[model samples]
Target: MRCRYPPGMPFYAYILLCNDGSYYVGHTDDLDFRLGQHQAGALGGYTAKRLPVKLVWSESFPTRDEAFAAERRIKGWSRAKKEALIAGDWELVSRLARNRQGA
Candidate 1:
């Protein structure tokens, strides 16, 4: 069998655009398989109720630690920040953070 991951490989941090127009953030070692689970309602959580989730964003890290950290960080982000991320608007994200800091 082909190896899905080599030793010491990085994991992935991903964002899903749910049918409810909300976003979900998560981390996984196998992105395709994890996404499949969410799609099939195997995960049976947030994405389950909001099926038909589409992968809108993903970033790989050198380690699961980094991916997990990113997931937690993004989960704390506002909808605008997450939308900025999905839109690849780094400047908007930065501006939002700066505004948040000033508030």
Candidate 2:
């Protein structure tokens, strides 16, 4: 069975601040459920072992593809870039990306 999102559903690109001071990036249409899963360790894997995860950042998109693309992009970013993003510092993120380029 295929489950389709309702009309006007919003998808999200989210970053979690793990207990060990690392970030986890992911996309979901249902943010609350996904967060709950991570918090309870039901999701398993990276966040499960880290435990005590907190919702650090998130951006909403009208479509799942946009949210997914954002997630993938963030996943490739360096810690500095991710921190810049979490701080909502677009200038810093661009600077970091450029500095890391061609290296």
Candidate 3:
């Protein structure tokens, strides 16, 4: 889902498509500022090394904990599952999950 805040401030779980075609999952309370940091290489970590990252997908949550949980969950996903999520293809994500379980 896109970033949608409810009434008060919202936390976000986000996916970044890196320059090297890799994916990075993270959570933050301020999406825009965090993105700016990543783009500017201020964070000095994974996204920094893979500079010029792009925000591919993000979802707003009511609480920081929820956003963090989503980030962790997405981080554990396979490339296909992550791509399915980016495409908003829940069915494909489910099928991929099932296939992984079966394997």
Candidate 4:
């Protein structure tokens, strides 16, 4: 079932800095509620044990599928790519993107 937030807001692709200095990425329609669940350990998964996570970055999408797709793509990215994305270093991300194409 789809998340029921407003009528036509957007889904959020979010990244969190875990307490262990790692990162977690996910997508949800309600950013605040989802982040709260992660922080409260209510999700009972990776982020749950990695409590005290802080919201580091987020991107909005027109649909939940788009947000989830982006989250999945980012989840497979290298540390450098993730860092670059977190830092809003579009140039670095673009470089990494080009490198992935072996160009």
Q: Which candidate is the best by TM-score?
A: 2
Give lDDT per model, in order.
Answer: 0.94, 0.95, 0.95, 0.92
Better of 1 and 4 by lDDT: 1
**What TM-score, over all chains together, does every model reach?**
0.91, 0.92, 0.90, 0.90
lDDT of 1: 0.94
lDDT of 2 by residue, 42-77 (tens): 989999999999999999999999999999999999
Every candidate's CA RMSD: 3.7, 2.0, 5.1, 2.2
After superposition, which runs of candidate 4 have C-alpha atoms over 4 Å from their true positions? 1-7
Task: Give the clashing residue pairs of candidate 4, or none.
Answer: none
* Clash pairs, model 1 backbone: none
Residues 1-103, model 4: lDDT tens digits: 8666565789999899999999999999889999999999999989989889999999999988899999999999988899999999999999999999897
Clashing residue pairs in candidate 2 (N, C-alpha, C atoms within 3 angstroms): none
For model 1, the stretches where C-alpha displacement exceeds 4 angstroms are 1-5
> Regarding lDDT, does 2 or 4 come out ahead?
2
**Residue 71 displacement (Å), model 4:** 0.7
Model 1 alpha-carbon miss at residue 65, Å:
0.6
TM-score of 3: 0.90
